[model samples]
Target: MTLDLPLIWAGLIAFAVLAYVVLDGFDLGVGILFPLIRGEPHRDEAMNSVAPVWDGNETWLVLGGGGLLAVFPLAYAIIMSALYVPIIVMLLALVFRGVAFEFRWKTQRGKFLWDWSFAAGSTLAAFAQGVALGALVQGIPVANRAYAGGWWDWLTPFSILTGFALVIGYALLGATWLIWKTEGHVQRRAYDIAFWVAPATLLLIGVVSLWTPFLSGPYMARWFAWPQVLLVAVVPLAVLGAGFLLIRGLTERREIAPFLASLLLFVLCFIGLGISFFPHLVPNSVTIWEAAAPDNSLSFLLVGGVVLIPIILAYTAYAYWVFRGKVNAAGGYH
Candidate 1:
């Protein structure tokens, strides 16, 4: 039997992207909540909550991007051409956020500025990522194997809504994370913020989920068609279950359940998106096979990926295992 290299690579790339979102998302969420955190000590707790794992969480991002470039050069080219502005902005924001992450600990006088920088960077990066995702889901304008859209095509109202939605979602993630990883003032404040942000995130998720189907006929058909409906029906029920648990966790003062619930909500959303975007890498334009690299090249890459991926997973698991437990209020991992 001929192995479906394209399909395999597509799934691998999808997994990488999802890993990035679920892993790096909380740290970015911590940054997004910076303004609401109050006091340098609270912020320190927040930062320390993610200090050991934040940089490592970004490896999936690198893997996802590089995999796309190597495995789907055509799609990468078109997407980059379409989303150059947002992509650039996201990269620059991430750079600023990383600098602030380290330099904040170094300087006493400029610490406040670094704090703002971190917040701005995280917020902007999250917004830009959402916008880029929205634009992609809305479909890139492609002609003769190239992007044919205007520079500002990514700045639509729908995209803006996704941007705001992502910001809210990330804030919720950060708050829930604080709930899991900190105590005293930071934890209480996080619980308070999470109680509000959770509903807002769900509201935006509903808005975006509703708006998505109408963007393309295929999306609507895939969601509403008979057998597909039976299959897709599970997503909404799962989302509702996750939401219920999230609210219950926050209300009952459960520490870790809310964070797990929030992550489950994101996983469901990602799965829903996968349902919408499968087969077509460019959504209505290019198929996975069409955009994929040659089988020989894919085969070579897969060998390396198999070895590298497990190692990555191993180290990531080890890091979290070592750092498990509430972040220390007085001192953090150096």
Candidate 2:
């Protein structure tokens, strides 16, 4: 079968977003869960769990944004323009969180401040991303590929709901990561959080589903239409299965199983969103084909992907392989 460039680009974008969600999701989750962790020892253990992998995980985010800028300039410009404030806030939060991660280890006196910064920054970044997503889904106030509304146009009820939902989602991811990385008290606490957070995340999904049709007219048609509805239904069912598995694993004290199950649930939910917003890159404002860059630019990006993606995968795998053992207080960030 012939390759449709638009579809291919859409798939690439989806892959990048999913990679960001899975890889960076855990670290962001860890940040949000930071406030709940007691004492310096547990905090170090939590930070160490992601130290080697966290920086590398952020690489996909760079690639996703950069690739969009290069390969889909129109969409990039429009999205950035519409989401200017939120994106700026997200970047600042990310920067603050990263700095806190480094400085908290070195500074002895201001540790509490750094901890709050990290957690607050993580929460801020995650919420901004969710709001941006909601705005995109709800269709930005656009005309002629330009934002036609005021600055607060993105701050709808739908966006706020999505913001909180994403926080819960990221927390769930972090809890799973903890289950995989730490042991004893830390692991137990993480498991408990996972058990509780899973239901909340599911509820958020339900709310988004219920709210989408009312907020966007096309959502109901896209979701409930014949064969598409069946495909969409599969995602929620898969999420439920994963949730069940996660709960069972946690109950049985199955160690790594709960984390894996949670990761699967995240992937299923992401897939569902991708399907829900297939052709639209800027929601109803612009389509993938219309927003895409020239074929030459795409070809260039594909070439870079050939070299960069494998290296990223290899390094990530090697890091995980080296850090396979359980996290402990003594596990210093080298």
Candidate 3:
């Protein structure tokens, strides 16, 4: 089969996005789960669980956006234009979360403020990302490859639903991370949260699945088709199985297995979405080839990717390896 540069670029972009969601999603979830509990020791355990790897997790976002700008300039421009406000909000949220992550440890009197800041920032960032995704999936108001809609066009009920879905999704990740990293009371709390959040997230996925077809006729057609339908059906079953296994593993005190299962569920869900939306970077508005940059530009990006992606992978691996093993209450950030 002949290689399609646009399809290759699309796959690369999808990889970057999925990496971001998997890596950063748990850290963001940790932030969201922070305020729900009380006491410093528990909080420290939560922070340390993500401390070694959170920064590295964000690298995927940079790579994803950079890849889009480099190899799919048209799609980048149109998406940025349509999602200007939400993107700005997402950036600010990230900034706030990053700053608060460091400063909260140093300051005592205003620590609560920073904690809330961290949670709020994470929540906003995750929600904005989901909203942007939902808006894309729902289709931007585009004419002649340009966005043609009011600023508020991105803030539909569908976007709102997606936003909350992401919040729950991230919360599930956070809960699982806690299960992996903490012991005793904290682990119990995390498991409890997961028990509740998992079903909610599953429901949200169902809702999105049901709504997506009505929202986009082409998406419905793509999903309901023969072999594709089989693959799509497999994703939900895998997700449900993973979720069920997670609950069982946690209840059985299987330690690390539940976290891994939860991560697998998230990955499966993301893959399902990617499958549903392949070849269309901007839903119905723009095909990947139309949105992609010239072959020469993509070739340049491919060269950069050869070098950069490995370095990213190596550093990420090193970070996780260095930070391996369970965190304890005595083990706080330095």
Residue lDDT tens for model 2, 180-281: 778888988898898889789878978887777666656777778888788678877887888789778878888788778878977887776766676788
lDDT of 3 by residue, 1-334 (tens): 5668788878877888989998899999999888886787888778878887988899999999988988888888888999998889998999999999999889999988998998999999999988988887788877877888878888999999998999899998898888887887888889888888878887898899789878877888777888778867887788789878877886787778877887897788778777667767887778899998888887777888878888989989988887887887666422
Q: Could you estimate the TM-score for every candidate?
A: 0.98, 0.95, 0.95
Record all residue pairs in model 2 with backbone atoms less than 3 Å apart, i.e. clashing.
none
Supply the TM-score for candidate 2. Answer: 0.95
- Of 1 and 2, the candidate ranking higher by lDDT: 1
Model 3 lDDT, residue 269, Cα: 75
RMSD of each: 1.2, 1.9, 1.9
In what order do the candidates fall by lDDT, top score first?
1, 3, 2
